[model samples]
Target: MQDPVEIGPYPRKPPVTIVDWAMLVLAIVSVIYLAWITFWHVSDDIHRTIVYVDYGVCAIFAIEFCWRWRREGWGWRFPVRNWYEVLGMIPVTNPAFRGFRLLRIVVVLARLGRAADRAVGDRVTAAVVNKFVNTIVDVIKRPITVAMLDEVADVLQHGRYTTNIANALEENRAELDAMILERIRKDPQAGRLKFVPFHDDIVRIATDTTFRIVFQVLEDPRTDELVSDLVRENLDQIKESVREKDIVRRPGATR
Candidate 1:
């Protein structure tokens, strides 16, 4: 036999077993029989026997409900959520209220439907949805427009790109100075300069002055505009150089 399907608050075992289904069927039949007796107004001994059967069926349900409640650790929520079941299981002379147990049929059918969907429909639905999305994306996608590319280029060219670079350089100035000093100390040509009494002081002053001059030059708005204009003018030459190199490397290309 297939393994039982567990759902809801049941932790260690399946919430509904074969025995639970049997009890459910019994509860449903008892409700229908009680309804029949009420409609026909039966006053015979058979009515008394049916009444006892009704009590027996309700007892089974009450036991199953409590068993599930404790097993699943549902705490107080069980009574609140399944108040209908609680009412149906209450032993009473009138059969009118017993009809409420019929709702259990709806609950059972819903659970079964959910189980079936989980078993097969979930995978089928996901596959169909994935294919549909892929097809739509492949059909609708297009290359980015020239306007979009121009907007991106403008941001890089005229935005705070250079300002951010200058800020980063300022932040790492100490580290950069140390790296330059290390390089100078390791150089053979700088041996004479290292022997000078104020070598460290001279290097610090020179490095700071050079950094300030470069930073000022780069920070100038006119310098950025000039560089942009130069690149724009030479764009054709850059493209031609790349194409020429590509052609020269081709299998049948002549010198």
Candidate 2:
């Protein structure tokens, strides 16, 4: 039998297990600790005592990142999108600024919820660990995104894209065709034109949807007012021009 091809870190989705439980606990602790830091502000004495504890939790995430990278086998890329987690590893002597912590409450809670959802593994997307952490994380990542875009542009210039594309198409062709056929069959509006080809269906749907939108806009009172104003302006101009012509022309001359 042919071995499965390894594409990246998560070759296949991992099942929920004790590790997920541990990660969930760590996340809960992190949220509580952050809340304490946010509302009450950790003092120097307490910060010194729990400093290693903070480092230890951050270390676990850092190791997880490395573990995932190593598991990628041959096909691997740097986890640039996860740049936020690195902030967690940085040991701060003082609590983060009060204003920032207040802002991060929603972000931190949102990530914690994602972690919880992952543990449950329902109809939601699978995720683990904190979404790399911090309110400032978003603001600083625009430049990184640009840099990543540059890497993409660079790869497009040199990567074995056509070979990869051919292999992907070859592997998924049956499933892709099935998906197209299924979508066409399932589409309520397209069912009427069941005889239409896939491309034709797409074109018909887009054209019909856009045509309906245009008609709706034309029927709108705002559009009606705009057209009315435009017509009135043109009629007024035409009337003024005719009145001028009448004043200048001889009484018997053809206007």
Candidate 3:
């Protein structure tokens, strides 16, 4: 069996190479060719010119694509190769596949620009674009926190549960205030309040009085009992945490 032939080193490198310049000029000329075909006369002369232009652009792009594929180390793989490197050969597919082709152009341009920037010791354009894109995204996301908090507060003020609580408190304000006053009067250690807090503060209201009416369901003896139970539970948790902290700070407390 014959042994495989090995490829030698690249004959030329980058900007100094005529092949690279020719590829770029061919890409530019292809744009002109496309414009001519898109808007020129239909005489045989014009048709022939467009045909030749297409053929020339196709040939140049094919050669450039093949060279890039091999240079990028895709010589060994068979069908499972660098398919993206050879995109320009399919011209008719360009309209439907314009995005894919543009991606290939981006890769080539990025490579060239990166090399040029490295040689000149500057990537100012790339850095500026990156920063600008990041700033735009940050600006778009800046209002998300305020929007979320506003939504939470709105729900708490107008939701069915809160609305029910508000209605119950308003309809039975005298009874509710009597409960608060009785508790404070009976227990000197009870939490102090200048007056029973108004229900409007806890719910949506639209009157000069600013007083809210609790829904009848919440004013029901059963639901009100449950609310009282929950409030006590929460108060117990708070008192426990405070007592634990106070105990820890006592003079002879354990570490």
TM-score of each model, in listed order: 0.36, 0.35, 0.29
Q: List the residue pairs that clash in candidate 1.
A: none
Model 1, 107-149: lDDT tens digits are: 3333332233233432233344366966644433321223334
* Candidate 2, superposed: residue stretches over 4 Å from native: 1-15, 74-78, 81-117, 120-255
* Model 2: per-residue Cα lDDT over 155-232, one tens digit each: 444444334544666577567656665776689986667665676557556655654565566556666556546655
Q: Which lDDT tens digits does candidate 3 get at residues 1-255?
A: 889967443323433446545654665555555545444546667656666665667676667556655776665662133332233344532334333433434334444433343333334335544669667455543344344444444444333554465766668877765665566556655433324375433222322133422354554566655655665565556556655665675579985
Candidate with more favorable, higher TM-score: 1 or 2: 1
Compared with the true structure, all predictions reach lDDT values of 0.61, 0.54, 0.49
lDDT of 2: 0.54
For candidate 3, what is the lDDT? 0.49
